[model samples]
Target chain A: QKEVEQDPGPLSVPEGAIVSLNCTYSNSAFQYFMWYRQYSRKGPELLMYTYSSGNKEDGRFTAQVDKSSKYISLFIRDSQPSDSATYLCAMGVDSNYQLIWGAGTKLIIKP
Target chain B: DAGVTQSPTHLIKTRGQQVTLRCSPKSGHDTVSWYQQALGQGPQFIFQYYEEEERQRGNFPDRFSGHQFPNYSSELNVNALLLGDSALYLCASSLVGADEQFFGPGTRLTVL
Candidate 1:
């Protein structure tokens, strides 16, 4: 199995809808979790970051990590069309020097 | 401050050719890391450079090599490029002890 697994979602959601993207991992040593958003033809942009298990909120975005289940999620509240992009979940063992990433889930927030 | 900057925003090269891509870390940052993002995939770490030395590397083969300069800028060199080497090459920068990486507009390489 891949170290990190994420659904290759071309998930479409209507604007203002609640959006939830998730990934599961096999490594228990991963302690730092991150969410990145990438627009077409652009590099992945850092969105949310967290250490271990917990919930972090940034405006309309919320990231939660469940170490027990080896799963992590990014929730977008009141999604907008501008939010359409690929979302990637990555984990680091101890520091930022090494990060294991998942195949991103592509999202489309329709107007 | 300027974010990470990569040169030759787009490149087209024939298979078996070699190419060199350069990156200047974000202002005030001292470490540089390179990643490869294939179509429909998340960015994969290739390697990282700190203090003019290779600090970490991912699963990529020896055909993929890199260098860090005294000014904290870096270069990624691909030798014996294959069709599979075509991808969006991304450069990211972070300060020492800083975990979050800020990325540059990547260089898109197309191996013909």
Candidate 2:
């Protein structure tokens, strides 16, 4: 199995809907989790970052990590059309080095 | 402050041709890493450079190599590239102790 697994969801949600994206990993050594948003033909933009486990919130985005289960999630509240992009989950044993990434989930917030 | 920047925003090359992509890290950052993102896939780590040395590498072949300069800027060179080498090449920078990396706009390489 891949070290990190994420559903490649082309998830479509109506405006103002709640969107939840998730990833599961097999490597327990991974301690740092991150979320990145990428638009078409652009680089992946870092969104939320968390070390160990717990929840970190930034405006409409919330990232939660469960190290015990090796699962992580990013939640988008009140999604908007501008939020349409591919969301990627990344993890590293050390926050300063190489990261393992999961295939991103494409989200479309319809107007 | 200026963010990481990459050159030759887009490139097209024939199979068996070599390509060199450049990147300048963000100010005050000393480490540079490279990743390849194919269409419909997540970015895959190629290698990372620090202190003008190769610190770590992923499962990529020897055909994929990189360098880090004294200024912390970096270059990725692909020798005798194959069509499969075509992808969006991304450069990311971070300080040794900084966990989150800042990415450049990336160089899109197309091997025909």
Candidate 3:
């Protein structure tokens, strides 16, 4: 099984709808979790960063990590067309900064 | 302040050819990491450099290598490339021991 698993979704939603993207990992050592947004042909842009097993909120985005369940989630409120992009979840252990990434879920916010 | 920057926005090469991609880290950052993102996939970590030395590496083969200069800029060199080498090569920079990393625009490599 892969270390990290995420649905490669072209999840379509209306503008102003709430969107939820999630990832699951089999590694128990992950202590740092992050969510990144990538526009087509562009590099991944960090959207949220959180330490183990908790929720962190910024502006209209919220990131939650559940170490016990080996799951992480990013919730977007009031999504917009500009929010249409690929959402990736990445995690790292305390030993080194190397990150294991999810396959990413593509989100489309229609107007 | 400028974020991370990479050179040669796009490149095309034949199989077995060598390619070199460059990156300049953000100001005051001392560590640089490289990743490869294939179509429809997340970025895969290749390796990371700090203090002009290789600090860590992922599962990539030896044909993939990198170097970091004293100025904190870095270069990724792929030798004996195969068609699978074609992907978006990304450069990310961060302060040593920091959890957050800033990424460059990336070099899109196509091996035909």
Candidate number of the best DockQ: 2
Best by lDDT: 2
Question: What is the total number of backbone clashes in candidate 1?
Answer: 0
- lDDT for B17 in candidate 2 is 96
Native A-B contact fraction in model 2:
0.78
> What does candidate 2's lDDT look like per residue over A24-96, in tens digits?
9999889899999999988899999999688999999999999988899999999999999999999999887
Runs off by more than 4 Å, candidate 3: none
lDDT of 1 by residue, A1-111 (tens): 999999998999999999999999999989999999999888889999999688999999999999999999999999999999999998898566878889999999999
Model 3 lDDT per residue over B1-112, tens place:
9999999999999999999999999999999999999999989999999999999899999999999999999999999999999999999999987778999989999999
Quote the B-chain TM-score, candidate 3: 0.98
Q: Which scores higher on lDDT, 1 or 3? A: 3
lDDT of 1 by residue, B52-95 (tens): 99889999999999999889999999999999999999999999
Measured over all alpha carbons after superposition, the RMSD of each candidate to the real structure, in angstroms, is 0.8, 0.8, 1.0
Query: What does candidate 3's lDDT look like per residue over A43-77, in tens digits?
Result: 99999898867898999999999899999999999
* TM-score, cand. 2 vs. native: 0.98
Of the true interface contacts, each candidate retains a share of 0.69, 0.78, 0.57
Question: Model 2: per-residue lDDT, tens digit, B11-47?
Answer: 9999999999999999999999999999989999999
